[model samples]
Target: MPATYNTDGAEDPDLYAQLMTERYGPLRLILAERNRPAPPRQARANLTPDPRAAEHRHQLLEALNNRPQPDPEPAA
Candidate 1:
C-alpha cells in the first residue's frame, strides 16, 4: 500500500489521519498518532563456537541448512 503524506509540506501532521481513523476505528488511530519507530530486526548467533550458549544450537543449524520450501501459489 502506498503511504500518504501531506502535500502542503507539513512535517508534524499525519496525512492519513482521517482515513486511518475511519478504517481502523478510534483506539488504533490513537496508537498510530503516537508515531513510534518500528522494532529492531532480530539477530542470529554464530553456531561454530565450542561453548554454545543455546542448547538448541544444533537444531537451529540443521533448520538453517535445510532447503527452503517453495511459496504456495496465490489464490485465484
Candidate 2:
C-alpha cells in the first residue's frame, strides 16, 4: 500500500505546490513552435531485395534440422 497525505482543510498555495511537487515531480514547461511544418520525405522509384537473404534462410533451416532432440521420458 502507498502512503497518502491529508491536507486537513488547509488551502495554502505554497503548501499545495509543495505537496504536488512531492507527490509528482517539479513542474515543467515545454515551449515549441506548433505552427512549424515537418520536412517532406523522399520517394524511392526502385527497391531491390538483398542477395544473401536465401543463403541466410538456408543456414537457419540447416541449424534447426541439425539440432539434437531431447531423450524421451521413461514409461511410468
Candidate 3:
C-alpha cells in the first residue's frame, strides 16, 4: 500500500496554517523560529596529543627492526 493516502484535492495553505496555529499556538513564532539563523559552530582544537600514538609508533618500529636475519655463510 502507498504510504500516504490519496486526497481528493490539495489542502488550503491558509487553512492548514490556522489548524497548525490552533494546535501549536502562534504561527508567527513558529515561522520566526523556522527561519532564524542557526547558532555558530564551535571549532574543536586538539589541546593535547594522544599518548598512545607515540607508544604504538615505537612498537611498530621495534617490530620492523627485529625481523629475522639470514644465517651467516659457512667456510667453503
In candidate 2, residue 54 scores what lDDT?
Answer: 100
Off by over 4 Å in 1: 1-22, 26-35, 42-44, 52-76
Candidate 2 per-residue lDDT over residues 1-76, each given as its tens digit: 1133334566785697677767665444211233356688678754788799999999999999999999999999
Off by over 4 Å in 3: 1-17, 44-76
Which candidate wins on lDDT?
Answer: 3
Could you tell me the lDDT of residue 65 within candidate 3?
A: 90
Give lDDT for model 2. Answer: 0.65
Which sequence of candidate numbers ranks them by lDDT, best first?
3, 2, 1
For candidate 3, what's the RMSD?
14.6
Superposed by TM-score, candidate 2 places the C-alpha of residue 12 at a distance from the truth, in angstroms, of 34
lDDT on C-alpha atoms for all candidate structures: 0.62, 0.65, 0.70
lDDT of 1 by residue, 1-76 (tens): 1244332554535645555556666654456776777788758776567665475787788888896978999999
Largest TM-score belongs to which candidate? Answer: 2
lDDT of 3 at 56: 94
TM per candidate: 0.19, 0.34, 0.33
lDDT of 2 at 69: 90
Q: Cα RMSD to native, each candidate? A: 13.5, 11.6, 14.6
